[model samples]
Target: MWSFRTVLTTALVGLQVAALLAVLALTYFASQNVLLAYAEKLTERVARDTTTFTENFLNPADDAAALSQRLAESAVLGTADRAALERYFYEVLRSRADFAGIFYGAADGSFTFVSRDTSVPGAAYRIKTIETAPVRVVELRYVDPEFRPVSRRNDDADPYDPRTRPWYVKAKASPEVVWTEPYIFFSSQRPGITVAKAVRADERLGMRGAVGIDIEINALSAFLSGLEVGERGSAAIVAQSGDVIAHPRPSLVSAGGDQPTQRFAKLTEVDDPALAEAVASLPGGLASLQPGETRLTRFTAGGESWRGAVRRLAASRTPWVVVTTLPESDILGPIHRVRNIALAVLVAVAAATAGIGVLLARAVTKPIKALATQAGRISEGDFDDVPLPPMRIRELDDTRQAMRRATSWLRERRRENLALTGQLREAGRVLERRVEERTRELAAANRELEIANRNSNMLAHELDHRVKNLFAITSSLVALAARTATTPADVATAARGRINALARAHASTKDATDGTLAAIVRSVLEPYAGLEGFRLSMEGEPVTIRGANVTPVGLILYELATNAAKYGALRASGGTLEVAWRRIGDGCAVELIWSELPNEPVGEGMIAEPASAGFGSMVIEAMATRLDATLQRQLTPHGLRVVLTMRGLEEGGPLHGSAQAGGPAAGHSRGDAARRRAWTA
Candidate 1:
């Protein structure tokens, strides 16, 4: 019943329009749901982030108060030390910018406070002290960053007393730390809250005191104002008691006048219509919200739809609420715009398609059969370029020419593909060779790294062993010194001298493969060589001592030198000391002789027993026993002379019997016996 051209035009146009309409419908609905979800998620993320930030800002005040309480309880800080307390509070305020002030109030109505001084031009901190005992007066000192006083004022008429403040009262009553409700600071007149804790009377000065730190809320408001909410969106912090703690507009949260009783502004007085409506729309208001619970609501205010999320701060001792609101248009406006654009495109495209379809149907209906036959021939690879029957229409002729050109282009592309395939194969071979070389290089590098790691591990083990030995020696010295010394000062002096001797010995031998007896003697006695009228002479053949013998030999030398410096040779002046060593017993043993000549004459009876058989004699005897060496002392008219004979002095020789046989317990027993003998003598 229909002509071929008419049927084709009608079918093509109808199918295109139907497909376009279906795609538009699906895209619009899917996008609408996605945009709505995105808006909800964005609002919730803002609310959660704001709540977290608020908690962080207030946590520092709590921490500072706790720290102050501990210091007070431990008696490290007390009210009587007003100067120290003031300095400490000033430092705390300088370090913590968020704190408005730090103060301590005593039960006797005495107070010490430090706060930021913005009233003065060049002042960085202000110290306020109220004395109730000797004088009832307030002293104000404004200081700079270096604590230099810039200005000082005496306020004798000021009636401010910290004991009457709410923070002080609450802290004194509560056993634990407490936070006061948000109110205006007495000095700054800024809306803030205080974190305070009570100091037990028995702990410090036998009197009770409370410490408080004030945190301002204006910074919180500024933080909210700077937050990136959606366009035309706003956020606020509200307390459960119906006070607005923070708002994007900072002025809305603070009362303008000097009414301290009504310092904080209520939510209704903020003059933000959208925020007010959103809070009112919540069921039972923000007070009904539980901690860590989030509630979302929608409302209309000022003839615009608004969406909001209300979340309470979690784990907060203070009940604070975070509210974030956004207009509904911020979410749906973009979706609607995109939908309108799609519709316009659909209309333009549909009109063009229908018109083109009609023309195409009319033009191609006659010449289509001829074109199909030629296409079939081309599909079969018959590219002989045989001339076809001539077409009357120009479009059909041009299509015929284009088909020939396309066949030519296909043949050329086939030739180029073959060439390209060969080149790719060559490139693959080259890449394989390069990969093999790189693998070989990496393998070589891995082997080197493994060798280096083994060397590092070996060095670490050696260092650890040496450090442990040094610690053992130091601990023994400290214990022995503590046991024999009479006073704490004596203990410290004895231990420090012995430790220094050991440190010097270690440093001298740290870089050498083996330590020489002469080097150890010089290192131990170097400190006394610069004394006036003192002379030190050394005569020795360089004898190598085993690593295990270095510390003991060095300590023995130190004790003898210290005795000479204290009582015999180098005590007053004009003293000479001689240290000599020689290899003995087939070059395996060494004998060291220490000879001292003092400026003062010594009697034989006075030298029969050592002047003081104290820690020095004990140390010398114990060390000789530990080394398995013999120590002989002879007192002559010249001075004191000592001979120390040690075996197994060679680096390769077996260590001494005592060093190999004695553990810590054996060594300690010998030391105890030696100390007892010295005490008895």
Candidate 2:
């Protein structure tokens, strides 16, 4: 026989066990999510740090030519001019935010440089800046920078010639400056960045020599190292070209030095394909498809399932990308623990709840037990039943009174409960009917939505096709008009101008099928790229405008170009032209300037403002009005300037480093002859 105490104890134990299991399960899931979040955060942080590192690392001057200019300015010094070279090197190093060393590789074998080791006095004139590392100087007659063999000996060795190195060789081969990913310094045993420029005598004479700078990676490492993803989070720095600068694990064990190699033979010894691939494709921002607790894959090291985030560092110049990793287990582990604690608490509460339920059940049964005793007493012929000692519970007292009342009207309540139950069953039946009707209505709505979606897709496709055809038609019309002109020169000029305009509009509209208004203006006016004739400036950053608006802008620019080509300063020799547009407060402004040669007389016959409003003038006025712009035309002895200020297309406000009227575009690619012809004729 089970006593009450034994039963209660057994139930409590069972409840506790159930609660503990629930807590453990919840803990496991919560911990996993937390770890995943942490991993993603870590990756993002690494990416951001790397991007910032690269941006500040490059330290580009407001002038792009500054780097090359500095090299040229210093190269003029004599070979034996160590003091001048050192001064220039120190100045160059100081100009950068992350330079660890600066060196100039002249055509001659002699090399001059400054190192990060400030402890070594500037006056300490050793044959070479590096004193300790074994110098394996390889004279690759074939290699520009002969591969310097890694040596351990400190004895007197040949000067480590950098010309034989890849960085020096590549820079020498190209006219443009080159930046290399971070790598361990062969001499200093520290990670650093290298930027090289092919020194030239002037703009015309190219690649006279090469000057280089190396920026240390210690500060970047510090930034990435401090980021915490979760419990066990890690971060790494990678170059834009996917070269791993910093990582948590050592996939490639450099034999003597820390140079990472992709030799499959070495990778086979380790037998980690994932790690090998990761090493081979490192510094890349990508992930694998294999599913696991870890959300991101492949890039992270082996055995550690983790969530990953990545960001590109210092956007201005360097292409370093930072990757941060969070071990899923570490970040989520605490949350799981907290969940378990909560589950345990909930379980204890559940057990208490169950115990209370049992007590309430017992209280309800007490009255029945009392009734049984009373019935027995009545059977024994004791008519006077002492009213059960005043009931403790109100429900029990009500029950007792009900029982006495039932002695008089017991049959009526039984019928009432039965009748109410019958009514409840009928109400349920009606509710079921209503639900069915609602379900039918929902199905109809779904069908309607499907039809609407189909129609919308069809409409979109038709719109795209029509827009393309409209552009083609417009282009054809312009070509025909150019060809139909009566005079041969006029025909050729018109055909050329109209064709160019159409082509420009088409180029801008490549993304839109037909060019947007903004695209049309940019492409048509682009040929007058760097005109000294007039000041051309843009106020608004380029924007995508509607096709309807694009046509008007295109027509207006065509008229302006035609007038300038025929009679404006653009027709005069040595004249300059500038066309620019930009968004201002709640509007946009487009200005075109044609500055004539000094003392050049204005052509009254061809250049006097059109006596009667022609299509060109009308078109200009209409377009300006459409854009809600204020139009101005000013004629100066030096040039004619046209200004149009249109509302609703303004670029925010003013910006730094903005192009001024007559300034060249951000990336103008034409040569001198093209620029000169466009401005003068």
Candidate 3:
């Protein structure tokens, strides 16, 4: 049979299990929200950091090209000093290892350069210089890493004109430094681009020259190759038009590699079946996208689902997207793992809780079952040989004791009824005696249960009384906090914060658990903290404070804090604040220092106190009196300095606080009943 104990326990435990499941579900969704936010922040940071690196790498080349342009406009190139020009190119090329060459072309079809020695493998000591004029000739030279020439010679080469070169034409058309299309250098046979700026010695003289630097594109490829995304995920930089500029995987951008026969490929033209399929899944062929736009798509690749994202590079001059792709397993594996772990925990807890409920129900029902047997014996009038067991339960034991007394009384009456029945001739007297004894036993059990019931009611009433008192006090504090306010917004701001502070004390211990003095200060300063870049520096050991002590402490700090925000460091952009505290005198007392320094200094006359006492001033002084600790205020040239020495609460827990915290429009409230009375007056 299902006993009352089993039903009640099952009902309670079932409700608890349902609640647990609800909480777990909420927790999972909340974690997903947090992790999604984290992932977005991570991607944004990666893009920004890469942008910084690219800018840093490229800015110097532009600066060097501009400097050479300025040098070319000077007399160094005006007189056509072949010797001076050759030396200048050599110095510039030697400074950067990746610089293929530095060149300067004149309007009169003359070109000169200092380029690497590509004629021999691993040759670093010598470089080639080619010059053209009335005669086209090439000079071979040796130089150190610092560009001091070691040897020089003139060489035979094909005729080349500076005016016919693409860079010279591009420079004349451009007012600022310009980058040319990527192409192979004649000397090195390696792909590169030139950064050039045009220079004129004198505009009226009609003498113009272009100074340029060629940077190898292979360096960019090497950099991009090192970047990675998630597991099995790779990043690639692709031009908006259609070209794949850089990628870690060679197959994605080229038919083969850095070879003469291999052609550079685009995302839309990869020969690899997997990559081709991935690109085909995109709605358009990568050209429809704009800068900073990101999109995700899935495609079947290598017999697995693949996820990829394409985001335009915000810093690239030409439209370029950074694409990251990986198999779905690589990204969703961890999420799946977390889900399985949560399910396991839920199952384990539910089983453990149900097991506990079953055991508890059995223990409770065992006693009640024994009591039921004793009640049956009394009802059947079987007083001679009745089975009655002792119970460990207090109430059940009391019932058993009552039944035993009833049995003893009926036995004595049965002996008297035997003697009287012989004279009166009625055997029903003994049965009547047994009925009377059973009724008395039932009445005694009822009285004992009533006493237990009264005790339970008294405890519940005490608990309710305490709860009501807390609410009444909170209501009073809220009302008092808004007493000085004239607007609804102001009243809301003031009343809400003080009430929240009281509520926080009830919700969490706040005695000592990592957040103590520092936390309390943050709660009071939160409103002012909303100002952009506004800072509140707090430093201290955890100060444990509790109970009524919070009232004076919260109120006192709020008063001083409101004043500081109104007229001190928080008012100016350049201003700063410092708050520090330390435990003192056997850790029973703590000394806290609050100091604010403004953007600029004020005169000594500004140190004077206020002309009239405001309500805030009255509250501050009133709470300060109750602190039973030393308080000092100093006015400096920069701002205000307030030092407080407060004794520890008589009984304190430890922690930070909980409050949604209104803005600075609302003020703090009177804490103690004594202080509230004075404020009202």
Candidate 4:
């Protein structure tokens, strides 16, 4: 089956990936900016702390000069005990580790200074005293930590003059403590700067001497190296003129030389490219940089950008710049690490999302496929007998419900269709039967219509002939009776009686409420019951005659009895006749027999046929034909025997003869008093 799983899964995965990428991208850049700003702030703080450390080191020197000035004004320095003064100097030497010397330079070009000496294999203090008497002269010496003279040297008369030194010069020029220009210390031959103050015992005794202390380059370099900057960070102290007086990288402070090598280099003239770039980016050559404010500088070095922070030390008399620089790459390393971690998390999340998409797509599509198959089954008229499992997906569940409803509806329709089919079959059967009955009725009606048409054509002539035959039959009977009458009145009475019998016979055939074979026979024999010479016997199983067939049966019986009454049975002193009718043949047909018994002597001249065989014979023949009956005659010693057989008599049957067979000669039906004289055989 075709499915949407692939498309849906792909869409879901695509949406998840796009969302993750968007989040990762946004985080990478956003965090990059935040982390870089935080690192910048950190680097600035480190630079500030380093500068503060340098400034604090110089503050002590200025405090010492203030103490000496107060003591000189009180005459304590000039009158102090020698041992006490030496103790004071020894205490000063041990006060700070970075102090190279504490000395006094006289206005007359004489100088004296104390120092800690370690070159003599034992801890000691050294002192330098200068004399300008008889040409400039100098002496170098060493001292114990207690200010006891440990070693001394009369070096030489030298061109060096303490009075001409910047410290003495600056001390005499200013009332406040002064900082000298950075230079190599005369005793240690190390680069240094001095903080000096002028001192006098009394105002009248003019300037006596300059008290000074020196900060050597080695001490400053140690302080700079101890700076806890970034992994690739470097620190330096630059003088106001952009001179690097001290730095962690000594090359950054000095040019290479052996002859009293220059201990400092201009900030812009530093040998290291990265350091030079850092120096070049200083704010106003570091002199104009404000204290407590970080001056951030970015410059390219070694094909990479570096950030340098410079702050002018507010406490330095020489006005120095404390500078720290770090590579931009290291500063952003943590940001990149965070970014990579975020990317990995995004990848993992996307993978999980894809997996979930596939699972959900299967969950949805499996049910959909089942529903589709069920729908196809329903289309093919198989509405039930298929299993439908439940689903978890919302849309799939809704669809399953709809499918169930559809299948139920189809089942209902199928049941209704089955019922309707049964009803239609029943209706068809009823319609078919009705159609057959109508066909039979139409056939019967067609037969009746044909009979009516024939009756229409023969009605007028048949009526005229029937009327004439009635008159003729009456006249014949009257003529035959007159020959046997004694008088004219007697002849008339006999004719009337005979005519009344014919009239009653016709009426009997007409008013037949009882139309059975035996009933009709009894009705016809009513007139002959009281005859003195006649005996009649009617015997047979009773049978009913159809209405159309009744008239013919009654008329034929009357004719036969008429002949017996005229010349055969009723003429004798003891006459006998028998009439019988019964169901015969297939139980669906019947027969009636008629014959006479001998009352007088048998003779060869007995009536061979009816005396005229005229009206009676023709009527009898017509009735027999209409009834579809058989007739037989034979001569016997007692009388003539006549038999008649009819078929299809048990039920109303098809007519075979005449359109008019209702009455005989218009008066001879319903018939004679004694209809049949039978042999009873």
Identify the candidate with maximal lDDT: 1
Per-residue CA lDDT of model 2 for 497-553, tens digit only, reads: 655755564445333333323345456555444333334333324344444455555
Candidate 4 displacement at residue 479 in angstroms: 99
* TM-score for all models, in order of appearance: 0.47, 0.36, 0.42, 0.45
Arranged by lDDT with the best first, the candidates are 1, 4, 3, 2
CA RMSD for every model? Answer: 22.5, 24.7, 29.1, 63.8
Off by over 4 Å in 3: 1-25, 76-79, 121-132, 138-159, 183-191, 204-207, 225-228, 249-263, 268-318, 324-332, 344-681
lDDT of 4 by residue, 1-681 (tens): 446777787787778778878887887778767866765776678778777777776788788877755654565565234344445666876877777777776678776767666776444876666667786667776665655566667877556677887788888888889987787655466677788888876666789787787766576787778776678777777776766788886545665466555556775577657667876776566556665556778889999888777777765466777777788778788877877787788778768877887888886577677887888888899888567787777887798878888888889989999999999999999999999999999999999999999778556544564466446556755765676689999888878886787677657764554356666776676555544445777765535577777778887887676666555664454778787766565567777888777587656555343534565666677788988988887667777788888886543532222211122212332333223332121
Task: Identify the runs in model 2 with alpha carbons over 4 angstroms from their true place.
Answer: 1-46, 60-82, 91-98, 116-162, 239-244, 247-305, 312-320, 329-334, 349-681
- True lDDT of residue 367, candidate 2: 59
Instruction: Give the whole-model CA lDDT for all candidates, comma-separated.
Output: 0.76, 0.52, 0.62, 0.69
Q: What are the clashing pairs of model 1?
A: none
The sequence of per-residue lDDT tens digits that candidate 3 reaches over residues 1-681 is: 566676866776678778877887787677766654554444444444554455566677789898888877776554277778777777777778878778777776666677776354434445544555566676677665566656666667555667777778888887788877555555555546688888876656654778888886566657666776556655556565556666665435554455655445755676444445545676886676666667666678878876666677554444556655666565556776887887788778777777777877886687687767766776676675466676667877788788778888887888898898796655577778999999999999999999999889755754564365355545544555455678989778876776676555433322323334445666655444433344566655545565556666766665555445445665445556777776567757777787877665655433233212654455556566786877788886667888888775434532222211122211333121110110000
**TM-score: model 1 vs. ground truth:** 0.47
